[model samples]
Target: MQQIILQPQTPDELRLVKQFAKVMKIKATTIKETPKARKKREILDGIERGLAEIKLHQEGKITLKTAQQVLDEL
Candidate 1:
């Protein structure tokens, strides 16, 4: 293994070195996907709403003709 030392001459250079070190440390760490419970709940709610819409269309609560007309207006 090889070791390198960085010596910043100016205040701006020191700040830049510190920022670079922080970015390097973050990049070296393993990233994990950990969704919060609230986020999970929101995703599930969105899915349920989509299913309800489908059910309403199937039951003729929302006519396909009206849906097509609305979509065409967009």
Candidate 2:
């Protein structure tokens, strides 16, 4: 058996495609995480890294100022 992937342009098309799949016995695994989801993951990763830096700052391993101070230095 072969597999086919689809990217429907509209909500109506998505609904229709899912209905067609149901009638055709084609098992569908709707992905909860898509390209947008990948982008979200990237954002969360950056947040985690920033939090790690903040933790270091809290331990006095690095000394950083507020946003306004950084901006003033620029």
Candidate 3:
């Protein structure tokens, strides 16, 4: 048996997929993210945002917060 992964972006899409799976007699399951998985995803997202901001700063399109300013915000 082969496994398929589907990531529906909206509720409507998810419902449609579920309906299709049901009609096809396929077992569909929802995987919930654990706290650790959620944290890791958040960290990775932050890193991506930071890298984008750094790129914008290098391009002189936006100014980034100084290390002291970031510390103060924290």
Candidate 4:
């Protein structure tokens, strides 16, 4: 693995790097590999699709009455 060195001249820079390292480590530990990441991506894609549908409805590509009816059904 490659190594990184943080040469912080100021106390604030040192503190910032420490906090950044902590968060980076936490994220590295929690990272999921391909299959799990794909599942997460699918879920996010569904959410984006839903948002796009709502936007289209608002923009008049889809009727407001139909949108309201769908929202009511939900």
Best candidate according to lDDT: 3
By TM-score, the candidates rank as 3, 2, 4, 1
lDDT of 4 by residue, 1-74 (tens): 76555456687986787788797783322232489877997899999998998899888897555667889998
1-74: candidate 1 lDDT, tens digit per residue: 65555656687986787788797883322223367855896899999998898899999898455677889999
RMSD of 1: 15.9
Q: After superposition, how far is residue 21 of candidate 2 from its true place, in Å?
A: 31
The backbone clash count of each candidate, in order, is: 0, 0, 0, 0
CA lDDT of every candidate:
0.71, 0.89, 0.92, 0.72
lDDT of 2: 0.89
Worst 10 residues of 2 by lDDT: 29-38
TM-score of 4: 0.40
The true-versus-predicted C-alpha distance at residue 34 of model 4, in Å, is 1.5
lDDT of 2 at 41: 77
Q: lDDT by residue for model 3 over 1-74, one digit each (tens)?
A: 99998878799998999999999999999887799998998999999998999999999999887889999988
TM-score: model 3 vs. ground truth: 0.59
Ranking by lDDT: 3, 2, 4, 1
Least accurate stretch of 10 residues (summed lDDT) in model 4? 24-33
| TM agreement with the true structure for every prediction | 0.38, 0.46, 0.59, 0.40
